[model samples]
Target chain A: MFAAAALALLVALILLVVRALKGPTVFDRLVAANSIGTEAILLLAVVGFLTGRPEFLDIGITYALLNLIGTLAVLKYFRFGDLSQSGGEEPEN
Target chain B: MEAVINMVLLTLLVVVTLGVVRLRNLFAVVILGSIYSFLMASVFIVLDAVDVAMTEASVGAGISTVLMLTVLSMTRVEEAKPAHSPLLPLFVASATAAILIYGTWDLPGFGLAQTPVNTHVGAAYLERSIADTGVPNVVTSVLASYRGFDTLGETAVVFTAGIGVLLLLRRGRSRARLKKRQEERT
Candidate 1:
């Protein structure tokens, strides 16, 4: 059953890769990349279970944190031209 | 099952890499590169190298993608066309890859206990690590105690790189401030 789930995740990954490569816009690619990260995290966890080494879930947790950070960083960079800049929405006192 | 997963991940890696190479848009290329790294980390996990997989996920997929995007923000997003044909480089790359694959043909099969790596020093390390360092994870004990100096060197290298980046960014900030002060004086 874990094997079947892992295979399904791999199939999802392939589909995500297709979206990423065929993207005509940067946002499309970005979304695909984010989804790919999600699929990868799932694959890692499922593979860990399949291998009977559930300890690999730690790596999955680490990956989840990194994926969140990376995706946010990219989105922030897209919105703000510079990473150092405070969000322009707030009026300075 | 492991073999099937490894093959799928490796194939995905190749596809993403090809996309990275063929795409001219830097942003899309960076995204594909991150995908490539994700697949690579999965491959490492399937191969039972959890620590390496963790490092790949954090460094390859996370930090490098951000770093590359920052670099792209500083420059034109479209890659410039090369002046020369890519044929020679392609031929060279293929030849190198072929040679590497040929070399691997003679290596022992994967996960064999009798392989030199498993039989030699690795066996000794595995046998002694828990007793020597009281670390449950053999990788942790090996990295922290038995091969402590190597790990220290790796840490020192990372520290040096971080300091170098900090110095460069500081210089750039100070220079900008100097320019602003000069403008104010005018």
Candidate 2:
């Protein structure tokens, strides 16, 4: 049962990869990338269960944190050319 | 089942690599690269290297993506067209890959317990790690206790690298404001 679920996740991952590759806009790619991160976390959990090592979920949690930070950083960079810049500050010259 | 997952993840990695190579838009390439890293981490998990998967997921998929995007924002979003023909590089890459594959032909079959690696310190560690470190997880014990100093050195190296990146990338608010005022006055 776990293996079947893993296979389904892989199928979803392939589709996500396609969208990331072929997306017309950068935002499209960003959405795809975010969904891919979610898929990866799920894949880690499912694979861990399949391997009978549920302890691997710790890594999944870490991945989740990193994914959230990474996405936010990217979005911030898109909004402000510099990551250090707060949006309330005057715009870049 | 494990092998099947590994193969599929590897295929996804290859497809993502092709996308990275084909795309001229730097932003899209960065996104594809993150996907590639996630696929690689999944592959590592399927191979039962959970520790490696974690590092790859955090560093490869997470930190590297932000770093590369920072670099992208600092430079052109679109890649410049190559000035030279790709033939030479292609030939070199193909030859290197062929040689590496040929070299691997001599490797022992996968998961053979009698392999030298399996019979070496790995076996000893497997046998003695728990007793030596009182840790249930062999990888954790090996990284944290058995090879504690080495891990410490690695941590120091990562720390120093982080410091270097921050020093390079950080722009002081005061400095920026000063520069802006100077520009305004001129």
Which model scores highest in DockQ?
A: 2
Q: Top TM-score: which candidate number?
A: 2
Residue-wise C-alpha lDDT for candidate 1, range B1-186, written one tens digit per residue: 888888877887888888888889887887888888888988887888888988898889887987887687679889999999999999999999999999999999978888878877998888888889999889989989988999999999998987886676567557756776898999
Candidate-wise lDDT, in order: 0.82, 0.85
Q: Candidate 2 regions off by >4 Å?
A: A87-90, B172-174, B184-186
Per-model TM values vs. the true structure = 0.88, 0.93
**Native-to-model Cα distance after best TM-score fit, residue A36 in candidate 2, in Å:** 1.1
* Candidate 1, pairs of clashing residues: none
Q: Native-vs-model 1 lDDT?
A: 0.82
DockQ in order: 0.64, 0.77
Model number with the top lDDT: 2
